[model samples]
Target: MKNYFDFILPTPVLFGPGMAERLPTELRRRGLARALVVTDRGVREAGILNPLLAGLDAAGVTCCVWDGVVSNPDADSVREGIEVAKRNRPDALVAVGGGSTLDTAKAIAGCLAAGVAEVFALREVKDPRASLPVFCLPTTSGTGSEVSYWVVITDRRTHEKVSIGDPALSPTLAVVDPLLTLSLPPRLTLWTGLDALTHAVEAFLSTAASSLSDLLVKEAITLVVKSLSCAVDVGDNLEARGDMALASLLAGAAMQHVGLGLVHAMSHQVGGFYDVHHGLANAILLPHVLKFNAPECPDKMKTLDNLVEGEGFMEWLKRLYEKYALSGEKVEIKEEDIPTMAERARANVNAQTNPRKAEVQDIMELYRKSFKVVE
Candidate 1:
């Protein structure tokens, strides 16, 4: 059987070492004047914001800082961010942290442009236009928010995390400078890198997978396998950092077209409910999800074996998890919570795109295996 697919790569990606140095030029190229710098308090305090501010100042671009973004960026966070952006009326937005900060910036930009305080008003259900141009500078190698069209935001009222995706929200420029990732803590480096790996693996096995996406996923998986450990162990290794960054970009590009799977669907529920880091949740669930899906997609699992190299692909992943200290400690995966989390995962958008047709029971079983609640 012949497979046909459509590919879209709209965001202009600027990748390499020190690419962040070009931020001023990129903003000016977009004809942006006043800019709102969106990021979290952590990154702001890390002193990472200094160089970016210097670049903007050197470019003579008037800018204001909004450092209130929180992890798992909730509705109220977006609303407060929008209020700030509206007051400043910045001509552009510069996102300067990880996925949470970038997602918040994307939402704030869209809401400010639409003149709505409620981000839900601009949800996939609503017809919202693109807002001020957004330029993303990702400090983490996960989530791929810099290149992806999707943004996951939690609605505080319902405690449900819904994703908003529109081509209109894609960043005008993605500055992937490996240097910024060098200071990341080891645990964060491991989690985020694993998240990037999950993106590649899921996209490769997606029912929507195409030849073009497969090419990207193949290379991405290889790079992640080879470099993730080094990047995690030696946080300051620029070469490893560069490889992971490129791997993340390729994975992001692939997911943009092929879509994700049950792992993401299930992970979203955990993130919304627990306020856990998105990458860690994805990491802990990845092996179990792979084990669940492996029976259905043996060929894809074998393809992964080429990168990780073990008696079998799943064993290879298990070994990698052990090697990275990602899988040793036993966390509780309560059988009781399976039904509820499974229901949520089943309802996620990515669930429909999973290669295996997962019934509620199938999802619950997978969740039961994946969840490790400390008890």
Candidate 2:
């Protein structure tokens, strides 16, 4: 037997339907009396904010809402959110929405704690000080930003999507309620599911992977393979949604230790260049990236194959994409753009952690495969 290593899940997790209703008690337990609720405008319009608001109100917590966060949250959004946090002087931050919103809240908390205005100035790994306490209520079942210590923010001036990781940014609490995700559209459900799948697969095959992380990643892969289609096809399937939530959480937990690989590295470029949805970008690139890394990690893919249905992981992924209408979605990628995107992806920090060493040629080939090739 392999020697066991220390494993820890510092963030307290609350799972199940209607679990978000307990947010008040969780915050009180942390002794946080005031909070800044950060979310996007669409989330507010979707009526997802009402339940969280009611919970905070019931807890006697004062909060100010900031709804300006956009897809691929940028430095401007972080700066504005930090300003809001300073003005409110909240004891904690509550992020309610998707990964973008959660990441925005994390940036806000980190910057406010460090007393910095430039989002890029705060070092992701160097600064040891902890950020303000953050509580996350994820409305989407992907990204796993609720539990991760990483924050992805865009530099509006340079058009670069920057990923920064620090233990300080990990949320103090994660409220994962499947009911909160019941209203997600089919397209979104598929995209986010693919992102979660990518996280699991990448982390499982990461060079830094440990036995514990491998176990979590394998479980996450199985759950995603089993439930993603049902969650997307039948939005009312609470059981499927529940499974996806668990998968996402497990994926988040896995990546916190094992990290990710090429798919995320490549997707960040798409997002930075075109402002694409993070999950959609990842979904479009997943199959091609998997194929690129297959040679280096065939054994891991074999393990994933066993989890899904034994020896055809790529085919299974393709079917899932087709089942969810994600297989035919139009992306703006062109053959000519491959060189630049590949260069950018290769430059990503996450690229270095891939178990397989990818060359520029490998990245270009992956890009060509990702290009919209209609049958």
Could you say which candidate leads in TM-score? 1
The lDDT values for all models are: 0.84, 0.84
Per-residue lDDT of candidate 1, residues 197-252 (tens digit): 98998998888888899999889888887888899889999999998999889999
Cα-based TM-score, every candidate: 0.95, 0.94
Clashes of 1: 3
Error of 2 at 287 (Å): 1.2
List the pairs of residues colliding in candidate 2: none
| lDDT per residue as tens, model 2, 82-129 | 888878888988899999999998888888777788788877436644
- Candidate 1 local distance difference test against the native: 0.84
